[model samples]
Target chain A: MLVFHTALMRPPVIDNLQYAKFSPRIFEEMRAGGVDAVHVTVAYHESFREMVLNLEQWNRWFEDHPDLIFRGTCAEDVLRAQQSGRTAIFFGFQNPSPIEDDIGLVEICHQLGVRFMQLTYNNQSLLATGCYEAEDTGLTRMGREVVAEMNRVGMVVDMSHSAERSTLEAIEHSTRPIAITHANPAWWHEALRNKSDTVLRALTEAGGMLGFSIYPHHLRGGSACTLDAFCAMIGEAAQRYGARHLGLGSDLCQDQPDSVVEWMRVGRWTKRIDYGEGSAAAPGFPPMPTWFAGNRDFGVIRQGLLAQGLSEAEVDGLMGGNWHRFYAESFGPA
Target chain B: MLVFHTALMRPPVIDNLQYAKFSPRIFEEMRAGGVDAVHVTVAYHESFREMVLNLEQWNRWFEDHPDLIFRGTCAEDVLRAQQSGRTAIFFGFQNPSPIEDDIGLVEICHQLGVRFMQLTYNNQSLLATGCYEAEDTGLTRMGREVVAEMNRVGMVVDMSHSAERSTLEAIEHSTRPIAITHANPAWWHEALRNKSDTVLRALTEAGGMLGFSIYPHHLRGGSACTLDAFCAMIGEAAQRYGARHLGLGSDLCQDQPDSVVEWMRVGRWTKRIDYGEGSAAAPGFPPMPTWFAGNRDFGVIRQGLLAQGLSEAEVDGLMGGNWHRFYAESFGPA
Candidate 1:
């Protein structure tokens, strides 16, 4: 009875944290915070060959840090990580670059354990319009096929950095539920990267998941956002949209230097620096909110949500249970 | 006056022949045939880097056979070749493999002297559906952008191997004239690779070009097709669609080994042999019509067209004059 109770009590906590400044300390932090799984960004602007090199680096990390982390290719891996008291890391691409122009690579990427792939990343891509493109052309010819292939192979279609029309079309076109693995509601933050209420509503209605972002640029008050305010926003979101579709994707960039942010925003595609949602005068990583700074800070968010009047179950879901459920369903062949 | 008359008599001829088993013998035959220009294919299923190696090989050929051939990037190159008593070899692609998924590579291909590109070849591609696919999904989202980019960069959109809907859409979408670089009209042969009269009419009406194919698979009677029969079909095509849109594309696979034919038809897309528009039992290059066995046979076709009641000027246009005019107009930025 005690064994069963302990198993029930240790339900997996997952974060779809888009990108993190990777180091052994970060894995330590994840373990400290009880993070069972995280969908880590493996490709932002990488070509297929470059992405393979990244996979090599990650393989080394898994070998070197076996106690703190393991590569998660499916929901079972998350459960295993929880059982072992370690964090499971799943690969994801913020752009479709790693697949390039070939539809065959979609299956190859799934074989490589890329669990989530955003159709675009802050600029018009071969697949769809990015959030920053002047005009949205929606899902491109290649984009439609790639989405179908991704769906078939069980790679979750992520539209976290895509424009509204493209994201909406992806949702309509994809057979499986898509994800905006990291972003908040535009109504709450008014950031260009944030989703509109229409997108959020349609997304949840279509069985898709939305991972509420904690990036400073996407917050209501940048780095100064209060824990109470952030929890209140999630509470209101739960009221407007069902709590089942809500989860936290903290989007932590802990211990990262400035240049890494530049690479994340403008990889090889541009000779000029594109600060994205941030201004050029301050094109570095913005200061994370004091209330929620790293993996360890997820507890603070859970406590604040409970204080903000969310039920304990609802708080649990927001912290990671929702994502744990989504990961279970999304990370396999449809 | 006699010298001027001699110069006028040697009118330049061009063929969008795709890939001929390129050799010095073929170049000599081209000179014998009075063929001033040929759009030689640089890629079938090759990526950009592999295509670059092909360019390197062609460069070696040009350097070794300078008296016989020169590179052609514009219509003027044809006239220059005519004056120099050499054949002008213009680069083309039978498939969009060289560009891969990067739209930026379109301009790079043009800069490398690629003047023509087919959207697909015997299968569905990133850009459009090939004729062999069960369901033709027309111009893909990427296809539209690629066509626009091709137009802006002055690359002729060839729809020889693409499906009907995709071909029609490409013609409609492309601002400049597109081409059915090689294939007979369906009214002439009814081959799966042949264009329908509807496609032909739409193509010519939109100021697009059609190149009469001499490849046996695309001919009415295969290798047994007679010169008079072939010429008669062109005469009928001229009556229905204006003579201005007609030119020679030959679809010639001269002097190629059977394995090379397999490469052209199957590429790297499939591991299994795909006898495109040919019987699997005889999955090799079909015999060339006895009357049109090599590049040196163009004059026989010209004479046969004249015998079938086309005027000297119409015969001239059919042989190469039309393509020369098209080359002049279409090979520069729109």
Candidate 2:
């Protein structure tokens, strides 16, 4: 049985809209949770040099934790790591900030095993505007060039945090497929982070994939979220976008601090939505737990799928098979 | 029966790109050309206030030449002016530099009866990057918002000097369609001002229109161009893009001083392409001719179409019907 955890987070730089902290223990927790691999992001509000330095740090960390963190550049690598009883860490970036204004950097990052790059974080960058931006200007001229370069270099352009126009423009401009590495549906949440039906259809029509997120702030009702509630959200998305194109992008900000949250709140990083500030934090959701707490464990997520009466095959697809297929198609052979 | 001269240009600003000195006689020349209505572009490289001032000057000019220069805003106005034996002067700006960074100014300009605005000139602005820019970053964040606002305010978004990405992004993002306004396809000549075939197709698909430019430098073999040669370029474009979406946008720079050309050559207002130290000029082209000489005479262009063996309807479409449809759809009523 190919059992893989689709949405696992190895936090240190993962900054949720509300909080940011570093938790080194999450990797161990993921292992205990039966997680085989996780897509780990590198770029986030960092300069080009800082991104390179962080990539170096990640490379060194993989070397230090050979049994724990095996770098997975492709689906085959993930399978191989799982077979060897090691956790596969696929390199990704939540934002294209590291690439900055130079489009050629996309090819460099792709060559360096950075397989997934979200077009924006929570705001506008040189490439694309994030969902939080008051306007979704789609792809910049450099952004269109970046999409072409990514296609040529085989890097996956992620649109988890992108504006609607940016997403549509990217879909139209890209010769290769794309992915929404983590997002919810606006039909359920009406949040900026949620994908609209038009956008979702456009993504799938372009042979892309979607990673339904588990962030509480993007849920319909503020916080008070349980694993079952998260599964219900995924169920609704699955019905609309189909389970085949759906996977989990747990958006788990494992270990981040309060200062990072402040940085996200105020900064000219991207324009803000007109719906008032600090709406990013779910009203009743407690501060993010150290790891997956309460009924938030992966097993609980599986149980929730059972509660939905989904078949074993469907469950398998949502859990990891779909993501594996997506990675293989997008990233090519190991 | 409803004949309109679609490619007519007002005399003053034309001198800037034409390298000919501005003179009062230029307006008489335009009237003698049988141009019933001319798109009078305000200054290209002027500040917002300067553009406003130019408009004021043109308004006064119309007041002075009551029988010759009538203010034209809609197709009906053009017809009315034509019936009254007057040259309808449709006020437009080659670039939105006059709007500066404020989105509200789009409405302000529209209210002031300015109909057309290219997002950028020969450089990057708050809205978009121009074709001449070394790095065509396309529409900036502000550019996307501006497009929506333009759609809302019923203003035409022209991409005459826009970067390829910016052009495509504008076409995709615009709700009420858009126009190339003035550009040649790179297929005819690999000039910076020429759009790619992909771009042309994208614009047509979005129900937008293309305004084929007859600037000699942008045509193959430059200054050696004749009406027949220019028509051949249009014929090829018409074959690919269909005549319904094609209209003439002769970039006739009639009465401009040599200093403006020098400024354009140095890219003083915009950055130069990377391969070249200076702005990309029309290759192998001689110095820009005086206004009427730079463009084929409307009558000669019609003769050229007939000589090219085009049907009467095709010639009519190329001459003005296409442009009439575009204006009617874009500007609405009169």
Candidate 3:
């Protein structure tokens, strides 16, 4: 009974957001944390060729650490990772830069194992407006074409870092469910990047999943936020949008220096400086909450959720069961 | 008065096929021939980067001899070339290799000013089967997608080197008019490279154009073929498919070595030699007819067409006016 429970009862543990400075140490940490699969951002402000170079780097990592990590293409890969005692690294793009203005690249990115692509990062893109943009234009012509293509090719259209109108339009226009792969509700903590209740309501109503982000800027108390408080917020969100539409996407930029943050904030778009989410004084990666620091700390969130009076089935769904179902349905042609 | 008649009354003279050993002398010959435009092959079996390098070479040529030739994107460029006394050079690919397996590069190639692309060179491709294949599988799945993309982005689909079934399918599948940019009708000359009546009818019925080839192998009497014989065939073709659907594509290979023919026939697809159009006994370019030996010899074809009793307007259309109209319609979004 103990063996069956350990092997079969535990659900696939998936993290739908990560852009870590990946190394052997992270692979070991992922294994230690029982991570079945992780959606990792492999492109920020890179061209198609540059993004391909990044994929080459990941290919080298996969080859070097086959025992710890391998590439994930579908939901079954998550179950495979669990049975094989390894983690499946799924690729994504934080911005549409990799595709550059070509709608056809949407399918090519899907072919390259990229399961999620955010239409915008933090400003206006060829596709859609980002969260930091002052004016929100829903979806550009190319953005609508790309959304339809992403649906056809089974790539999830992620609006995590997009503006409100654009995100709402994406949810309405996409034939398949689009994801806000890593974002918190603005009701939980007011942040420019946090989504509003209207957007969240439309997202879940469209069968889309909203992965709760533990990024400090999105938390109510920044880096000082506790696991209990985080779990309590998740429980409340579950009530608002139902437990089936919720999952964890810890936007952990682990082991990255401050320079990486600058790249993420202002990727080749500007020259001087546009400090995003951070000011000139504190223009760096914010301190991660002590309770949920890195890949190894997911256990504390699971325990905190249990303490917050959520049923075991609901906890399991949040801990990755829901994502597993989504991956199965969303990673193939419509 | 004669100068104005020579300049304004004459329509644009275009050769939609030429893989010449392009040099300053060739550009000078293009000017000498009163050729307003020529669609030149820029890729055979090149990868995307290799094709870009080839484009870089063309850019250098364009910069070096702006007086002799300029790049053309649409139909008006032909008129512009006639006014400027310069030939308009348009680029095309004899094979889909430049796009490799990525459909996204279809739009990228259009962005780079490639106006035409063939689905196959002389072998099976990811898109469609070539003439040399024993079984013509018609358009593959990627072929359908690429045809739609090519139609959307204004890249003319040229099926000169493809099999009959594939050509017919492309004519049926494409929303826009496709082209047989070079090759004669099999009814006149029984060459494997020539189009059958079924394919030609479908193509022209769908508003496509057929640019007649003057290559010796595709002629009724090979190297000994006469200008009168060629013009008579054109007259017959006009009777069958209307004069507006016919044009000239010379299929000229002036000053090209036999080795270039080898590359075209066997572009890294195999290890063994595929003599293609030439066997072990005769593995070199057959002599071009004396009446049309070089680009400067368009006068003879005109005289022959007039002798064949085609009206001036019909002769004008066959010369280049038809292609100019096709270009105006084909090289932009449908």
Candidate 4:
């Protein structure tokens, strides 16, 4: 019983990427890759005020590079980007720090053009416990209210770094479906950050989304992960959770210096170093797989999916179609 | 023991007023009143972004009216204002909307110099229930976390407009002493907005502060309430809660148009007019008592308190000494 805009009727290619060392060169790469819209991480450890500074910085980039990119707030905005041959940057927060402690800010952030927000970034947040936390406390008292507020405001509740219990509770508690914006299935990668079969089933059954990550740490073979293997994993996940619920989230930290990762992992929460997905020895971004090193490498994923025994329609969904539909349906007040 | 700066060694006059149609005239009035610092409401129904815009507007005010006003971030800022003969404008939120739903924003807001934030503003917020709500849900899962975060960040958890249960819970939960920045005792006025003796007992027992309101609706006889009667109420409150836990929060709406009250009462939440406190027939700013009409009237309250059997120290405390001590202690990380 839902109808989408004519702009969204066009075939849309979307990627829900986390963050990178954003620049005009990266915008060029997105355009070259034919990526219509990207859910770009705008905040990690930044507080509400710091996030505003980040938004201000992004505003400058948007003003300065109008030809390369435009700010995307809704599904139609993505189509607008495609039509104009520009990459659409959909703002998101890897953690809910930007909203701070007020539920009223959910709608406020949505009004500011942020389309997605993850409840936690790898620790026990006010809303939900992160995957790295020892015990998953599920949705806290504030989390339920926040999820409802987020649902009402059209801000996506992403559980990319959230624990299993918390993720499941968020999906159950939210009036609208939630999203695992960037994570692989644990069945494939076995990383702590990866989703389990139970999570995927619950997610897809409730009309949620799971954007597969191409981050080497979440890949089966790290930097040497094969396109064929990755595509096959997607095919298997689609067979289980359905193609409509899956898309590319490629947790790309492209061109970012290793030092920035420290902010991502430890932030100001601790004085000591925490390597997160990487070991203390390296504690830096692992080299991306050779086949999917950058934006231009998306085509390799497209071809690999085709060769991995998926129908063309399913392949289209895996690549971007599913995400576009999800966007049209998801990014609005319920 | 904390060592305050020599500037803070001077006697200070403070008021935690909600909002006024701020301008040069009001700042001049504050200077005329010899007001040292004021906790001004920067947000009520504003979202994170909207609040930022509000802060931006305040930033302009501070810049343009340097002689009249300056931004107050720390307790020391009040001292600076006193030394400079300017009113230090300390930022606060009547509602927690500025922080939204992210706990990290509490610290971020502190970083931005928000010294006080109420848990609710006459409605059920994510953190706690406001005074006007039919049902009061105590601190939600997120509320407790936010309280802790606010405590850690030095943002005072104000329960001025929060419901009783929520207010009591906030006072109980916060590691730092909370504040009822503006409200009369229910036993004196019997208004829905006023606090009960039980709340006051718990508040002061926990070392929290209670600022007396001069808002007409919260008065015993509305706008006609006498300064003698008001001073008597403060005298009673001082007897019960101790003089150290009492200060003046006049809740002045000086120079504001009637339309702005509508925004405070019905901020984007309701399409219909909610003549809160005032009836539909006369939904506007009530005439303030003749004895306390503007910033200059603070002296009258000081004189009235002295006449009402309060010692010089207690009168000074009621005027602003308590708030100055509170600012020194509460406006820093616990």
What DockQ, on C-alphas, does every prediction get?
0.01, 0.01, 0.02, 0.02
| lDDT tens per residue, model 2, A1-334 | 4334445522111111111231335656656666666787776777655665566566556646766666677777666755666657777787787776766556546645788888887778788898777887788888888788787667888888788999999988888888887777787778778889999999987878887666556655545566666778778767777787777777665455544445444444446522222445532223432234521266666778878877767777777777777776777521
- Stretches > 4 Å off in candidate 4: A1-10, B1-334
- How well does candidate 1 score on lDDT at residue B105? 69
Ordered by TM-score, highest first, the candidates read 3, 4, 1, 2
Q: What lDDT score is found at residue A229 in candidate 3?
A: 84
Best by TM-score: 3
**Residue pairs with backbone atoms closer than 3 Å in model 1 (clashes):** A141-B141, A141-B142
Q: Residue B284 CA error for candidate 1 (Å)?
A: 16
> What TM-score does the A-chain of candidate 2 achieve?
0.84
- The candidate, 2 or 3, that scores higher on TM-score is 3
lDDT of 1 by residue, A1-334 (tens): 0122334666567888747779899899999988888889899889876786687677668758989998888777877888889999999999999888866667656756788999998999899999998899999999999998888768999999999999999999999888998899999999889999999998999989999888999999899998898889999999998888999887887888898988988788889988887786888899988887788877787789999888988877787778877877887767
Question: Which window of ten consecutive residues has the lowest lDDT sum in model 2 chain B?
Answer: B10-19
* Candidate 1 per-residue lDDT over residues B1-334, each given as its tens digit: 0122334646678887658879998999999988889989899999976786687677668757999998898877877888899999999999999888977667667756889999999799999999999999999999999999899879999999999999999989999989999999887788789999999999999999999888888888899999999999999999999998999899888888899988988777778878876677988889988998888888788889999989988888888888988887798977
Error of 2 at A53 (Å): 1.7
User: Model 3, residue B182: what's the lDDT?
Assistant: 96
Q: Which stretches of candidate 1 lie over 4 Å from their true place?
A: A1-7, B1-334
> Compared with the true structure, what per-residue lDDT tens digits does model 3 show for residues B89-183?
99999999988887767766775689999999878999999998999999999999999989987999999999988998999999999999999
Each candidate's lDDT (Cα)?
A: 0.86, 0.67, 0.89, 0.86
Docking class of 1: incorrect
lDDT of 2 by residue, B107-130 (tens): 556645777888987678789988
